[model samples]
Target: MTTDILIEHRRDIADLKQRIKNRRLQVLGLFGTPIVLAVVLLVWAGLKISFWLHSDTPSAINNILGGVVAFLVLSVIVQLVAEFSEDFDVWRDRKTSVRELNLQLSLAEERHILEARRRTPPSMDRQASYKERLPGEIARLRYESQHYRRVHLLMQWLLFVSSSAISAVTAWYDPPQPAKGVLIGLGFTVTVITAAAGYFKPRERAFNLQQTADSIEQHATALELGIAPYNAMEEASNLELFATTVEGLRADQRMREQQLDQPQQGQQHVI
Candidate 1:
């Protein structure tokens, strides 16, 4: 009965990991195409705007205005897309968190089973079976968590670079008169600040991934010592630590959601 429960729990964890992996891939696919298109459009617009700004022809002003309008339209569209993508990422992360919580619950259950089985010394074959399988399960979870963290970090960096590029381009092509230039520079400064803030935002997934890795390392060490993990004093200590870490992550996630819900005061209209 205990073995069956353990197997079922392992399967549940495996399924959740697979779902998260697939969701990350889907997000990458959906946003990747649009980002590439946006970059291409931006580059084309930049070249055209540069040409128009440099020309001495009478129509240069009109051409420059048209290019600016086109760039603004495209920028707005890209910004909207980015907002949508961020919303999707939040939803996906919530789903991943729920799955992670479920996995942890399963691990707790498995620990209970191991505790029960430890009282009755198993045969060599049975002991060998667990020795072979437990490490693999722990390793797989660590790998999945690490991959998710990497993808998340990559997404943040991409947003930072893209937003900074957009702000720079806006400032370069539409250089304002002395008085207006100051206002434009201030606006650009705000955008740059926001982008930089995003890069430094607290990342719950990274924290959770690190906790998961630590848990796996503790489990592996316990297993190597021929210890029935759940019955080991150190193993129990590590599991409690893992639980505390996960709770901390959940609290941080709640705080972030609350911050997102609150409206910012005194921001100028971008349009």
Candidate 2:
């Protein structure tokens, strides 16, 4: 039973991590393309600035260079449609629901085991019960830690791409009135999106979840191997102590999870 639970959790984590890896590559390409073009624009600006400083440059050559600059600015819009699509929202939501179910199940089983132990003819099943749920908790935490780590990075890149694109477009060229208006609109859009991503605080949440997971793994590993701290005395004593430790960690984790879930009170996350 423990083996099966471990395998299922491991499988789910592996699947989620692979999907995150794939999405990271796709997003990096999408965002990187704009930065690459922006670099090209900066280089173009450098040349323009260099020529502007050189009074020895011929007028006709300078005129040709000006034409090149305008053409490049117009070309940026073509590259903006570097179209790629991934249904991240759908997959992330589904995985979140699965994880939440696992959490609820873990908590429920824990309560059931407690109630059983308190009965008149107390069942000697606490150890067995804890052993059953430990694998799932560990698996879920591992997945969540790594998942949030990916989300933090993806948002950072997105913020970079949008901000860099805005700077490159407005700073490097003087567009026509309508195009300049679009430039301002683009700046506002980037600001809003970047703000939204940052307001979620994915980086801090990722770190917190990762730390909690590592702490839980300490208990999980000890319980699994019957090691010291948890290995003292009889089997009942060991399992009872293990359950206490697990409950503490579970409470801490649930509080952290609750904090992460509080979207209305400014716990919003892009991932």
TM-scores of all predicted structures: 0.30, 0.48
- The true-versus-predicted C-alpha distance at residue 94 of model 2, in Å, is 30
Worst 10 residues of 2 by lDDT: 84-93
lDDT of 1 by residue, 212-259 (tens): 556556655655563544444664454444444444554654454455
Give the alpha-carbon lDDT of every model: 0.56, 0.65
TM-score of 2: 0.48
TM-score of 1: 0.30
Cα RMSD for candidates in order = 17.3, 18.0
